[model samples]
Target chain A: MLKIENLQARIEEKEILRGINLDIKPGEVHAIMGPNGSGKSTLASVLAGREDYEVTGGSVDFLGKDLLELSPEDRAKEGLFLAFQYPVEIPGVSTTNFMKTALNEKRKYHGLDPLDAAQFLKLMKEKMKLVQIDQALLSRSLNEGFSGGEKKRNEIFQMAMLEPKLAILDETDSGLDIDALRIVANGVNQLRSKDNSFLVVTHYQRLLEYIVPDYVHVLYKGRIVKSGTKDLALELEERGYDFIKEEVDQAIA
Target chain B: MDVKSNLKTAYSQQEGNSTHLASFQTENWKTFSGMGIPALKHEEWKYIPVKNIFKDEMNIAIESSNLEDTIIKKSILPGTEEANTIVFFNGRFQADHSIIHEKDALVVKSLETAAGDEDALFVEEHLGHSQAYHPDGVNALNGAFASGGAFIKLKKGKSLLQPLIIYHFSDSSNGFRFSQPRILASIEANAQITIVETYINIGGGESFTNEVIEICTGRDSITRYIKLQNEGKHSNHTGTTHVRQLERSNTHAVTITLDGAIVRNNLNMVMEDEHAESHMYGLYLLNGNTIADNHTIVDNRMPHCESNELYKGIMDDQSTGVFNGKIFVRKDSQKTNAYQSNKNILIGDQASANTKPQLEIFADDVKCSHGCTIGKLDEDALFYLRARGISEKNAKALLLQAFASDILGQIEHEAIKNYIEQLISERLSFQA
Candidate 1:
């Protein structure tokens, strides 16, 4: 479903993702556990086609197409979703309107009919409940004055509404309370299907306990230095990143 | 070009004759000619040069028989068809096009006609009265010419179901035309009325319009005014509006300046009675070389009065925008609450905005606050939209439109609100 070859990226002349490669197939969930500055968010931003990040070298392919060459909107139309760690607050625009426009745009790109008002409202009600989002909150401006937990849940609600084939949860648990974390993870787990895949990026293993991953990789300094199954996340949780750093350094020596 | 030069000389010569000019027309002409047009050196006119606009020779406003008749056929506010409608051509009121209804409840007539009457005394009282609040040359120039203004009076305990729509059309085929439209609206105690005024330039030639409006609201009266200015690129407009709450009234006014070459608007609200309330909202969308300047003042002179104001501007290209909002809580006005805010967006690298939200509070028990913000589009918001399958252009347009919707939502008329939405969208290239 996704492929990256020699992915070299930088921001403001500072090299972040230096020659890293990763691949994911359908029905597979990949967990990327990285320290504070291991280019975890950079990888998600590059995949999402954020213009500020310069892809200095290499290419990214998604669904057998040149992902790096596509614009951000086109990449989204091709079924790429990024659950931002910090959701933007767009005042005066209601969440319903924003989500409807986005969902229709993606649908139009896929050669589908735009949802009418009634149909759109029905879908919104269903998905909003699944994410435990308040209906009154959705009626207000988009993410305006929203709490951190509410913004994360809203993001998950949108991911459910759009149903993108490839979803990247970029540190979705960073600011969420335990309850919000459960709700967000439950929403993701409910939407899980064999045809869709997720790239979960986080620093803690608490979120992984709820939304289990198929594979866990430790990203150290822009490159993945260790790969294992779900147990690796638990081990890292019990031992912390220092154990992994020592192992990586000894291996390099 | 020679026409402009000749017009300048003609205007200067007329200034000399204006002093002796009989108050037979309006004593205002003398006041306007006495002060003349202001220059950039003046503190109030520092950003705008009113002198250079008239430096070239232009055509004196002439009555046009070929004026477009279909213009008055359109109503700016819904339900105005059954109400009184006043039409102005090149700054002169057209009686033949004027319509009136509700004879016993309302009195609608031209300023010249009302000036000749004493019983309809509001004409003499509030006509050009904004000068007391705004002493600038622009207000003086508008008051100096006393012709073609509209007069409206509402009887006590009367409520107008339909609004009064005023259309001020500027046509400059003869050359550069200058128009002065003075309007006086006086509502008696327990009366209610809504007025929607809009301007559109028809001809290709340059036109300069200076207009003043003075409103008086009696005890427990309610007045709502909506001003829309969408003049063409070659037009220049300077408008002043003065509103006074005589004895505890409620007033709401919104001004939307969508497009123009050079547009200036001055709005002043004086709360003279206790427990009065006022709200003012302004929005301007400018591109190209257009410049829009808005200056507003709210004075709380009585105890327990409140006023809130918000002005937003969206500028692009080489266009420039300015907003100066001032609020005053006089020493006698105890328990006054006033709030003012101005926000602007600069879409182009060359586009700029200058905003000053000022508050002067002398009452110890009053609460006053003012703030201003100027910024480019929020990148995080833009990317959030782009990542949702909206193209970059569309994303920016959405955010820009949202930035404007706060003020547009204040429009009480749904059709007018939709029209502004379409206009803003067209300017953003979001849709054809």
Candidate 2:
């Protein structure tokens, strides 16, 4: 469902994502693991069309369309979602209201009629149960004073509402407690289907244990040097990334 | 002829029209002539070009108003049909066009009539009281025409069934029109009232309105005042709302400016008695070449007085917004508390904002805090919204609406608040 070939990107003078290649079929999950400053988040940002990063060279194809040519909003409308590591706090905008706007905008882009109030509320109530989120939290300003767990759960709730074809979880477990991690993973598991895919980006392997990935790739120095099945994540968790670094250094030498 | 020569001619024409305000008008005319229009060098008037607004020859003479009742009725704010309506056309109070639903709760009269009647003492004590704080030609210019103003008083221990709505209309079809509408209101002891002031302009010619409304609250009384200015791009306005708490009273004021050529508002709260409290809130949402300038002052004259002030601005296009807040804690006003904040967002590249906070405290036991900020829209916040499938335009509208909701929430009157909210949403092209 998504493909990236030699996705070379940089931020200002620093080259971050250098010569990376990845391909994911529908109904599959791919986990990209790396150490600090290994360009894991940079790849996610580049795929989501964040303007701060410049794609010096590469191509991204999502369901036969060039993803890089679309604006951030257009990319979202085209069923591309990015769960930010740090959710923004927007004052005076209730999460419920924001989600309604976003859902309707996506519908309008696909030549579908906007959902009525009753229809929208009904859908929201159904999704609220999936993520174990409270209606009161959604009624308040979006993440204005939310706790770490609440913020992560709210991101998953938004993901459920949008129902994107490909959702990139960028460090969704960074600050979440164990309970929040379980809830988020469960929500993603419920939403997974044969027509949708996910890219799980993380520095730690704990998240992979809950939503086990079909494939695990180790990213080092902006390049994926190792790829294997789910067992690779368990191996990395036990041995740490130093072994991977040593192997890459020896190969370069 | 220039505005100064025309004003001089008008002043000479009404020199000997003996009335209750003859001496007051003459004195104020002298002060205005002495100071003239404020130049850019004047500290308080530096950001606003008051001189340019007066460069055109204005018709200072008060011609008989021929406004239609239908137009006046159409101009009344929604959800305020039961309000006590007062109409002022071309600076003269229109008694024939006004209405008082609850006669026993309050009294409304012409300033000229009230000055010579039993309320003469009250009017004399409160009229032109804002001059002491402003001390400028703008205040004196409005003072010179005080005889054509209105006088309103709420009876002791009485509360109006509904708010009082004042509609100031100016006709500039014939030429450059100039109007001065003065109001002196007194809330008697234990009384309560809400006052709303809005402006309307007829015809397309340029118009300038200089208004002064002085309110005095008696012991334990409460007063709420709201000013809404949206008179289009051809209109210029300068208004002063001076409120004094005589004995532990409470006062609240909100000023919202949406569109105008150049608008200046002066809001002053004088806490004259112990334990008095006041709140001042303002929002100026501008686009085009509109300039909205707000100046507020809080004077804590007695002990244990408290005041809070907040003013926000959103400048789009090439618009400019200016804010100057002053707080004073006198030596006798021990244990006083005052807080002031001003925030601005410049959406256009050429849009600009100027904010200044001045605090002078002579009491060692007082607490005062003031702050100001000017910035562009939060970029991260914008990107987050865009990433949620909302168009960039819609995202900006949503963020700007949120930025303005802070001041909008301060409006206690439900209908007026909803009305202002609708105007803001329409301006931002926002659905909600």
Most accurate candidate by lDDT: 2
Q: Could you give candidate 1's per-residue lDDT for residues B1-432 as a string of tens digits?
A: 553344334334332222212252345545655676777888777677667667355565345545556755653444445756778877767777777676678887776667667544556555656787776656765555555567778899998877777888777766677777778778889998888888867767888888888889999998988898887888888888889888999998999988877888999999989999999999988889888999999989999998989999989998989998888889899999898999999998999998877788888998888889999999989999889888788788889889999898887767667887887888788821
Residue-by-residue lDDT tens digits, candidate 2, B139-197: 99888878789999999999987999999999998877899999999899999999999
The CAPRI class of candidate 2 is medium
- Model 2, residue B6: C-alpha shift (Å): 1.6
Worst 10 residues of 2 chain B by lDDT: B11-20
DockQ of 1: 0.65
- After TM-score superposition, what is the CA distance of residue A219 in candidate 1 from its true location, in Å? 0.6
DockQ of each: 0.65, 0.72
* Candidate 1 displacement at residue A128 in angstroms: 2.7
Given candidate 2, what's the lDDT at residue B229? 96
**What's the distance in Å from true for residue A72, model 2?**
0.9
Q: How big is the positional error of residue B155 in model 1, measured in Å on the Cα after superposition?
A: 1.5
Off by over 4 Å in 2: B12-19
At residue A205, candidate 1 shows an lDDT of: 100
